[model samples]
Structures are given as C-alpha cells and as structure tokens.
Target: MKELTPVTIRPPFARYAHGVEIPAHWRIVQTSGQLGIRADDSIPEDAYAQAVICFEALSEILKSAGMTANDVAHISAYVTARDHMAGYMRARDTFMAHATRVPSSTLLIVSGFTRPEFKVEVEVLAAAP
Candidate 1:
C-alpha cells in the first residue's frame, strides 16, 4: 500500500519551484525572480549588467542548496529592452561558462517589470543528485 505525497519547494521561490512536489527522493531549489540590482542597491541599468547580476544571484541561491549551475534544469529570463538582446546573451553565456549542463531556457522581452529601473530578471530551476 503506497500513498502519494507532495513536496514543498518553498515560497517567494528563491529558484523556480512549484509548491507541489512528487513522490521521489530528489533535492530541488527554487529561486525567486532575480533582478539586476547589486548588493549595494544599484541596478546595472543595462541589459548586459542586469543579466550578469541576475545570474550571479541565481548562482548564490543554488550554492546555498549545495548545487551548481550544472544542476540547473531550466531557466526563464525576462528582458525589458529588446535592443539589448545581444548583450544579454553574451552576459548569460559568460556567466554559465562553468555550468555542468546547459539547461532548457526561455527568454522573453517585456514592457517592464515590478521595478521600472530594472533592465532584466531571471529565474532558474535546479534538480540535484
């Protein structure tokens, strides 16, 4: 006799996790939407800088869960400016340089975010071994 149970990833998702979980013994990390704001409360104001900052914050969250970018299984990115697409891509590639695996990703251009001053936001999902 087996019963089904759900897992609780977390709130304000620090990666990209849903509240529900499945029956499995796997480690997961969910991060909240990350913006380009620096530790000092200064935003990059540019796509490239924003992208880098967002990914760096994601990395930090992953690390807290004993994981790395390699463990990432999916990523969702939002850019405020389409003109900065190339710059954002460059920054993303550079940041994931050491990623264990390149996970599936989606990039979207949006009119704006909660913070009008932000240029980019990123959310990631990681499954650990």
Candidate 2:
C-alpha cells in the first residue's frame, strides 16, 4: 500500500494519510458499523470507552478475515456530538498504534445512534494480498 500525500495539498489533520493506494490482486474486506455495546449487554457512558469497545470489535472482525489493522485501507468513525471528538480520536490513535502503515480516516459527528446511550460507532475497510 502507498500513502498518497500530494505536495500541493495540506497534510492530514491527524495520524492518518490523506489517501491510500492498494495494490491490485489484494483482497478487501469491509465491516458494518460497530457500536460500543458489549456482549454482556453493557455500555459505557464515556465516549473513549465506547470507542475502545468499537475498535476491539473491529479487530475481531479483521481477525476473522485473516487480516489486522496493518491491512486497513480506510476508517469511518461517528460520534454523537462535538465533544466526543477528542475521545474518539484518542481511541482511534491507540487502535492504530501498531499499524505498519497509515490509512485514510474520516470522522463524523452525527445526531445520534440507535441507542441513546451509544456515544460512538466505527467501521473499517481493509485490504490484504
């Protein structure tokens, strides 16, 4: 994979690339948006905690496909409000800490989720050869 940061454009606002180029013949996997809910039917009130759960769930999904964060091509994350941005970013950074390459990322502030207690939701697109 190649990070596509053109000289003419401004650098990414965070620890991610403006774009990524996946090689031909690589297999791609996309995940549905994961909420912060746990299997035990527990949900955290904090955005960071919720985001962490979402990432962990995503990791499991990746593993099932024989891939990892290193193979991720893009990330799409959503939060309920503006205040959750910091927590979401922190969780996202920690999740990608071991990634071999930076991937494209998008963060959006939405009105809300299915459950009012839900503070964060995340999904990813990954590619592997």
Candidate 3:
C-alpha cells in the first residue's frame, strides 16, 4: 500500500490541506453522518457535549474499518448553530490529538438537522494501507 500525501498550493491556505492524494491500492471507507446520540439513545443538550459524542461515533466507525484517525483523509461537519463552531473545533481537536496527519475539512452551518435536538453531525472518509 502506498502512503497518502497532503497537497498544498503555492500560496498558503487555511489550517487544513487544500487536497489529499490517496494511494491506488489503499482501501477507502466513507462513513454515514453521525449524530450525538449516546449508548442509551439519549442526546446531549449542549453543543459541546453533542459534538464530543459525534466525534466519538466517527472514531468508532473508523475503528470498524480497520483505520484510525491518522488514516482520515477528509471530514465534513454540519452544525445547526453558528455559535457551536468553537465547541465543534474543540471536540475535533481532542479526537485528533494523536493524528499523524491532519485531514482536509469542511464545516457547514445549517438551519437544523433531521432531529432538532442534534446540534452537530460529522462524516468522515478514511483510507487504509
């Protein structure tokens, strides 16, 4: 399996890479959008708590695919409230603390989610060597 490379253009961009190159033989795993529902099927009231749960769910999906956060190539985050951005970033950074490489990321602030209680949703794409 070939290694994944993060590409940056001549001009400096944002904190994330402009693009990422996945090797030909590597397996890709794309996860469905994850919400902040806990094991007891309870949703958190605050954005920060919800964001942490969402990231945890994403991590579990990556583990099931035989990948870790380091293998993540891209991430998409959807938040219901713009004010929740800081909380979401904290959750994401905590989860990615051990990441070998940072993945390209996109954040969208939408009106609401399928369930109004859910303030954040996260989806991920990972590549396995």
The top-ranked prediction according to TM-score is 2
RMSD of 3: 2.8
lDDT-wise, the better of 2 and 3 is 2
lDDT of each: 0.73, 0.95, 0.83
For model 3, the local distance difference test gives: 0.83
Identify the leading candidate in terms of lDDT.
2
Residue clash pairs of candidate 3: none
TM-score per prediction, in order, is 0.77, 0.98, 0.88
Of 1 and 2, which scores higher on lDDT?
A: 2
Using TM-score as the yardstick, the better of models 1 and 2 is 2
lDDT of 2 at 83: 96
Which TM-score value belongs to model 1?
Answer: 0.77
Ranking by lDDT: 2, 3, 1
TM-score of 3: 0.88
Candidate 3, number of clashes: 0
Report the Cα lDDT for candidate 2. 0.95
Cα lDDT tens digits, model 3, 1-71, are 22233344353233455567788888999999989899999998988899899888888888888888888
Tens-digit lDDT string for candidate 1 (24-54):
6668777898999999999866788888888
Q: Tell me the RMSD of model 1 versus the true structure.
A: 8.9
